[model samples]
Target: MSFTGSLVLSGIGGLVYKYGGQQSERETEVPVGFQSLTIGFFQARIRVFRTRLETLSRTFWRQLVETSGYKYPIRGVSEMFRSGAYFFPWARAFAFYLVLYLTIAFIYFCTILPVYLALLAFLGPIGFAIAYLHFLLHSNMLTMMVMRFTQLHNSLFDLALVHNGKEIFVKTAIQSPTLPKRYYVPLNTYYFWLNYLPWRIFIFGFGFTVLIVLLLISFIPIIGPFIFNALISPFIARIYFSRFLRLKKLDNKQRNDEFYFNFGTYVSFGFVAGQLEILPFVSGLIYSSNSVGGGLFAIKALDSEHAAAPSGATAAATAAVSGSQARQDTTVA
Candidate 1:
């Protein structure tokens, strides 16, 4: 059977098992007639199962939004840019450059591919295969570079926040004493690219298949096309986050917080990318830079420990004075 068919059958079996089991239990406990008991139990189970499925669906969406990638809203991006935040403008500019480069590359590919195919007949299939492989390698390298850029942005912000004495209250904040500089390089350029070979191929194949399916289905009327295409946004976000999470620089807590906090932003960015593929570069740069600025703010807050300490010190002095007064009373008595 097809994968979708199998999934449907599994779902059906699960429902049957749940209802049948519940009916059996009810029949034994409730002193009602077996027929009535069975019917009531089945109805109750269906209601419960439906409620559970709905809840699960909602939770999945929430997770997709919350734990995806660079979670900053566009308004946050604008605010950071207006404030002359050091990271924001650079990130935005970088994003634009990256998008421009990608556009040019696509144009080149479209023009060159037909000529290459025609020439390959005179040349050999092996030469064409090698060229195609090289292209794939470069594409993977680009993806890795993007991931590194994200990591660097996050790291810079994290460091800035810590330095500033901010009470950075992300759920995960275990500090990394050292950062691996090599991990930030593009995949093809990395020394250990082979290590990720299996997973990379699997991910690429899955993504390619999904994209084809979405493109095919996206021509349908009303909700059909939009809904299928919408799936691409979350998938992109998921892949980006998965890459970000694999970075060695972040501690577990920081990674978790980053994943959860940035999911919505990632999803939004993905949706934007699907409609306008060039947007990812610009969005990535802006979001990463904003995060860096926020991190700096956090560091500044952390650094201002003097403000926090004075309140505690003052309270301690007050307690000491009260203690002295009590001692004097005791001595006098």
Candidate 2:
């Protein structure tokens, strides 16, 4: 696989690791595309589930307040849950946008490109290179956005766990809510260079060198191309994965563990998906869809639990305060 392809595959694996365990085992057999839709459906379900959880959380909070004689504030918790819920739909929309854009870009490149080049006088290597660069830049932007969305999702998970008195696995191996700042700052800095002038010149020069090497090695038969790629692929993937691990909040030790674990899982899943992709009917679709659906279900459940606990506590406190005030007024009168 290409460097970008590996990164994308690894990302999917990481997401599954983060959320897939919560889904029913039966639901995990479907393919990714189907699973993606199921995830969207589950996302909708989570919205509803979140509402119910919010109600329950408020109630639980009220009870806690009464029992402990503590103040439970509903406003802040309600607002936070509301914001978190908004993120789900926003993420869904963003995912759709990426899918749509990729489809359009593919069509333009494959279908329109040849025709446009034939008709235009200026269609040449320079034009093609520019177009390719544009695609690469756009892909990078999409990747950054996806990372940000995942971070937001993780934050929501943390809030939910904290609210519910659940212990979050906060060790190095886990993606913590605390890691985005460290990764994003550096990533954004790199991204700025990636998009700017001198860097693009450097990339073009590097790409030309690589192209020349590939052309030279093409004379050495099929094995030469494979050998070149094999040498380069691991280095590229390692750098990308390292950045990804940092972004996902894994420290050095944790990242090393997850790198091996996720790399193995990714290869396994990719093999299965690739095989299914070549199959006659809906086999691949079924597999991918199920995984995505299960993941969505799991995330929804976690968020529901988190939102419920806090809301429940707040509700209990409100009830207690109202009761206390009523009794005090009666006694005074």
Q: Which candidate is the best by lDDT?
A: 1
What CA RMSD would candidate 1 show? 20.0
Report lDDT per candidate.
0.41, 0.37
TM-score of each: 0.35, 0.26
Tens digit of lDDT per residue, candidate 1, span 1-333?
Answer: 122332344345434422321112111122134553445434543554464466555665665455332343332355445554445445554664466346443643565445545555555877577455433332222232233333334444443344344434332333433432211213432212432244347756996687557644632323333455356564444333432333333333234334344445556645543332223344445445444434432333334544666677887997589545433221111
What is the lDDT for 236 in model 2?
Answer: 26
lDDT of 2 by residue, 36-147 (tens): 3345434543554464456555554443233221111122224333444434543553464455346544654565345434544376776566445444433332233233
Q: Positional deviation of 206 in candidate 1, in angstroms?
A: 3.6
In model 2, the Cα lDDT at residue 165 comes to 41
Evaluated against the true structure, the overall lDDT of model 2 is 0.37
**Candidate 2 displacement at residue 190 in angstroms:** 23
Model 2: CA > 4 A from native: 1-112, 115-167, 170-249, 271-333
TM-score of 1: 0.35
